[model samples]
Target: MKKCRSLCMLFFVSFSLWNCEPDHKKYNLETSALLALTSTTSVPPGSSFKLPDANQTICYDTSGVTRACIGTGEDGEFTNTPAPFLLQIQDSGETILEESSELTWQRCPFGMVWTGSTCIGSSLNVYWQVANAYCNSLTTAGRNWRLPTAREASLLADHSQNTFLPNTYFPNGQGAGGWTSTPAVGFFGRYLVSSGGNVTPIDETTNFPFRCVSGPKAPNASFTDIGDGTIEEANTGLLIKKCAYGQADDSSCTGSASPLNWQQALDYCNNLNFASRTDWRLPSIRESYFISEPSIGNSNLPISIFPNSSQAAISWTGTTYNSTLSTAHAQMVYQMYVYSKTDSANVRARCVAGP
Candidate 1:
């Protein structure tokens, strides 16, 4: 029955089930099930998700270093020249509305109630189940609310540095980490920890701090094959290369995905010219994190969207936070990870264009 409703939604139709909202203050188990139990999505396709800048200002070299962003093609080099994540604080000041994704986020983390002036109270640490139960029952200005997915969870964190901090729009600081709805290997679910923590996959039964977000859920996988080796993602307006590094896009991306060091991977995308677009570059950490899949164990990315994918689908991002830390986003094997820039690790490169 849930599957049928999902298919109907894919064809531009949406379904509402058990919508006996006579009690707005209480959590409707049936209506809440539509968000938590059945599908990991709250909104249908065409609802956009925006990628905010990492807000990195200073550049870094391969070794112990601090530098400027004049020439280096790192994330710091393009710190909001044009495209930027626009967050609008609602009139109540308790909720925030992100312009690009159009999702309203609760200002406070779970367990901390919004007291108009600010969020007060200690954060509640509970299992994923408890977290969702709280989200369902709590009534804040009355909007459909649920736990954030991996992509939405990633956006709420402060990724400017390797450590976790308050989001620019978040008046109250975030907790250590939280449970995301996106499931990972086995019973483990994706935990959106600090930028350094890299969305660690852990047992979902464990207790952790979580935040609630209401409004449309970001699409799990929404892309249109542009027919010329590129697929344009409707949500972020990002054009990603269909093939991995070293694979030829001859209809089906053939051959093995090449493994290149961090520097080599950066160079590959920096100099890439395909589909008549020369603006291609190594994707930023946020951008790479955006192309995520919920079933991220064997391969989280949708096979129908990114077919013939490399078995080991780890790809480098241009996010170099400090001298030692950079990012590598994956669709098949690993989650978002931070690695030593000068390490001998060799990863693949999947380039992207647009903001």
Candidate 2:
């Protein structure tokens, strides 16, 4: 009985030892799962794996902490101050021409020659063709010069101050008349007029004084078709009506343009509503001149863009001469002239807006 009891105790001790042994398969699976979790997860605060945003540059601190450098200033610098860029042009002692228009004037007219600083107007007047050829052959400041266009010449006159070719820039006592590159519709080869800002047409064969201009030729006025029956002049930023008043078609004023008296024209323009705008009004003489395409000759207006433009000899302008309350100015663009007329006289109206 003692031996059997001892054997039973030994058997129970062996069973307990077997149960305490580790399972190698389960241990390997748990170890692999822990390694995967560590590999997929983000690195800790001081780890090298961390990165900055795509637009940012990485910056390092003295203490070995990584940081992002952002914004306009130099990387890692707090202040965002920027430096300004400037353009400077060298100046010569000669008169500085207008940069925007790139135009410079000779000190004297054609007949009177420019003798450096001043001019002598006693020279004989030359024919219009000779005047043009002389200007074309002129070489000033290494630039090929040419005769001034009608519009360019007109710009020299300050109508507001009633001044023609201010004496400060142009030599005084020189001939006040010059030939323009613009040609008249009915009369001669090219137009000639007095220097007093008047557009009196003179025959091309007649001798006249002329001024030389040096710069880029005046470009054809650009137009933007708004597709809403309105055209915008890119040069002057003026929006023009696609059709003239009393014209039946926008493509062409196949019918005669309706003529309204000065007051009626003003009222008609003020009441006009087209292209989703209602602030239309009669164009000023300057604005009217802006749309005039003297280079195109026909009607002295841009017929391709302004299809409904009237072929009429004269059109009413918003400008009024204070000399007489009853008279207002009209632009005879075909003839390249402006004249005062009775307010009651019927004239065509073309609406315009913006400066």
Stretches off by above 4 angstroms in model 2 are 1-96, 113-124, 173-177, 183-188, 193-202, 248-255, 261-272, 302-304, 308-311, 320-329
lDDT digits (tens) for residues 1-355 of candidate 2:
4234323433443344335423312223443344223112122343221111111123222222444433211122221111111111212322325334445666555445444555544544655555665666666567666767665564444222223344555555553358777655444455555554445556655667777766554444567877776788765567877677777645665666777766577667777777777767766544555666654655666677667446444666554432233344566653433433433445677777653
**For candidate 2, which ten residues in a row score worst on lDDT?**
79-88
Instruction: Name the candidate that leads on lDDT.
Output: 1
The lDDT per prediction is 0.63, 0.51
lDDT of 1 by residue, 16-72 (tens): 221332322344445344444523664666665455675666766666366777656
Top TM-score model? 1
TM-score of each: 0.77, 0.61
Tell me the lDDT of candidate 2: 0.51
lDDT of 1 at 2: 28
